[model samples]
Target: MGPSVMKKGLLLIALVVGGGCALFLYAAATRGLSAREAPSAAEAYATRTFRRWAVPANARLLRNPVPPNPETLRHGMEHWADHCATCHANDGSGKTTIGTNLYPKAPDMREKETQSLTDGELYYIIRNGVRMTGMPAWGNPEDGENDHETWTLVLFIRHLPQLGEEEKHLMSTLNPKTPSEIEEERQEEEFLSGKDLSKHKSTNGRKQ
Candidate 1:
């Protein structure tokens, strides 16, 4: 075929593919992509493909500088509990109400799909959140201080499969407490310290 004819053929093919994709998206939008519903196979594939390509080659190859020690693990656990537990859960299972409701859904880190990623890849995702996903960028790239925290998280992600119940219990304490929880802790401490319990009496004369 002549150069002009070949160009025309390729252009026609592109137009056809683009039109089909537009129609599919339109149909999906009308059908309702509910947050509570699991992502369709095509949606999952496209999201994964985009994420795979989004990370730079250098970022994927970069290694974690922080050593995987008990201290680092503890810090990572505390960080996860305070900041990530709401969505990811203490065990990285992503089974929490918020995690399950996200459009694409938070992935369970212990699963092969997540564990298969390299340390650097995981770090990149943590430092720079994936687009169109609930995961947020936890680290400021310009802040050197944030790098260690994210690297530690990468180690923690690796440790998810081996996470212990004792560690999870410890994390619960580190997790952020509500005002009611803080007040309850204060009252418990006072009671243990032999403070007057009469002040805590309810209308029925029972200690609340």
Candidate 2:
């Protein structure tokens, strides 16, 4: 209320922030900066709180323009399968190899920590990505106000809580497979169907 009290409040805030940073640095130094170690509860809370504050106030208030529908949700699911499943997984579990190994590890999107975020916050994170984490910014500067794909993704995130087994199976089909995985599937299918696998061999002796 008064200048003296306002100054004291600011000083107290500054002291808390400085102390937190010092402790973080000490932990990093003592803990040896290992990715395998899960973040402490305090660290996790601070990071989440900081991320929430980092988003612009206006951006947080913005709403998804893409209307949710079966078609749109399918499109979003497909996009997620091809692009996001590597880290987030088809069920938004964030349990894949890459996801589990990250320093902070990818979040379990089905949980309240993620689901509690507003659609706008989700969209912002999807488009802009959080700094100092594995997420990369996906927004194109040219897209401007017409980022329909990102908005649709927000809908899919909301749908994650209700993800069905069939939907996960479809997403697996849509996931980007490595060449070896494709070849393995082909070989398995041929063997199961009793097809002549040898006839498909190439000159290099690799499967055609």
Which of the numbered candidates is closest to the native, going by highest TM-score? 2
True-structure lDDT of candidate 2 = 0.89
**For candidate 1, what is the lDDT?**
0.87
Give one digit per residue, the lDDT tens place, for model 1 in 46-102.
Answer: 888788888888778888899999999988888899999899999999999899999
Compose the digit string of candidate 2's lDDT tens values, residues 32-124. Answer: 787877889999999999999998888888888888999999888998999999999999999999998887999999999999999878988
As a TM-score, model 1 comes out at 0.77
Off by over 4 Å in 1: 1-30, 144-146, 197-208
User: Where does candidate 2 stray beyond 4 Å?
Assistant: 1-30, 192-194, 202-208
- Which prediction has the highest lDDT against the true structure? 2
What clash pairs does model 2 have?
Answer: none
